[model samples]
Target: MAIKLEKVVETFYQKLEEGKIMGKKCTKCGAVEFPPVYACNSCGCWDMEWVEISGKAKMHSIVMPAPLSTKPEYKNLGKYAYGEIELEEGSRFNGVVRGMTKKKRKEILAAGKLPVPCHAAIYQRDGYKTVVFDLDEE
Candidate 1:
């Protein structure tokens, strides 16, 4: 029986509402897929199982949001930017990172910190919870 894609998404958000970050790990090749996919991106396997993520990740790259392109719904997320985030489980995805300013971005680049340590933060938006990254102070 094939699982519906919508069901996977529903389950992901449901788990988030319960304050547990979940990911699907492939039993065949041990690859964990963040955002909880029904199929594994690695090794082409559908044998995926739900696993809790550590909420730990690293920021690889940053891209500031363009003024005109910014969404009104995200206005509350002041000083945010898009970045390439690599989860501790080894999955890389583009995610919204909070607490980013132009000065901070410059400093991180000047200091040669390409992959700064960050942790996941669950943010409530509208009526649903979403995950975002905050740069770790340590």
Candidate 2:
């Protein structure tokens, strides 16, 4: 089966190509949804609006990818890990965070800094752009 790209997804990618991060904000409850959706997840409302995100976020948890489980497409990402990221606008989601190695992860965990500050970046893929996060400097 083929996956269909919804209008919201298409618009999101278009904005990424323009070097902007966009999200859907609920006009009713003032909740924002990153990775833009057509409806609001907070109040189950369909009254959503497109908003440019600040790309500021926090990584609450980190899980490194196993050596054998790494994908070829991500080989160019250097060191990365999956993490639960919370946007500054109050949206939470799991996303790939670049610049994280096992050693770095160990060091961070030892320091008891779980929810570290991170900022989003637009990564150029083979044919498209995507969002990734990098740990902020201490």
Candidate 3:
């Protein structure tokens, strides 16, 4: 039998390569897991299937990267921040959201907007590509 975690990662990448954003949907209960998992998080079911995601999400909060604390690994991920993200499928997570600046974060907060529409976008890295989300318009 394959390692559950490893299999989940493998399947996720395979789908991404095909330009399809896939997630795991539990058969035991109607729960969707992004960054797909082997077992259901909601009901602890092992019967899950690869389901395409709509790529729609929202930014519930923003946490700007600290100044003067640069990581060589992130030299390429220009202007990013760690923020709370929620998929339209109902999964919530914290991820790197690029193109976020301190001023922009404050501006967004000042507008009294905590959660804003966002969509998944593929980001190129030195080793492999990954996904990030972009703020959407009303």
Candidate 4:
């Protein structure tokens, strides 16, 4: 089981390096799991298939990271916040969203834009790649 889990993680990063965001689609219930899992959360089905995601999502809520809780590895990200992200394929998760500053958050809230459009991006880390999102320009 552990080895299988490791393989899933490895494959996920490998796909990101190839510029493709992947997710697992449950054959049983047609639910998609982002950051691809090995089973379906909706139906307890282990029959899953890999699929490239659309890279499109909506930001449902944003929460700024506190100064003390900031991680050094994220310094290069430049003004980001954690938010509830819902992928176009129906997966919902919390993800780091770049380009969201305190002032921008205020503006978005004042203007009544609670849920905004965002797109996925693969970020290059020191020795690995990961996914992040960018808010669509107003």
- Best-fitting candidate, scored by TM-score: 4
* Every candidate's lDDT: 0.91, 0.92, 0.83, 0.94
Candidate 2 per-residue lDDT over residues 1-138, each given as its tens digit:
023337788889999998889999999999999987776888899888899999999999999999999988888999999999999999999999999999999999999999999999999889999999999988
Q: Candidates' TM-scores?
A: 0.95, 0.95, 0.90, 0.98
Candidate 2 — worst ten consecutive residues by lDDT sum? 1-10
2 against 3, candidate with superior TM-score: 2
TM-score of predicted structure 1: 0.95
Ranking by TM-score: 4, 1, 2, 3
Per-residue error for 91 in candidate 1, Å, reads 0.3
- The candidate, 1 or 4, that scores higher on TM-score is 4
lDDT of 1: 0.91
Model 3 Cα displacement at 69 (Å)? Answer: 4.7
Judged by lDDT, which candidate is best?
4
Candidate 4 stretches greater than 4 Å from native: none
RMSD of each: 1.5, 2.2, 1.8, 0.7
lDDT of 4 by residue, 1-76 (tens): 9999999999999989999999999988999999799889899999999999999999999999999999888999
Residue 19 error for model 4, in Å? 0.5
TM-score between model 2 and native: 0.95
- How many pairs of residues collide in each model? 0, 0, 0, 0
**Cα lDDT over the full model 3:** 0.83
Candidate 3's TM-score reads 0.90
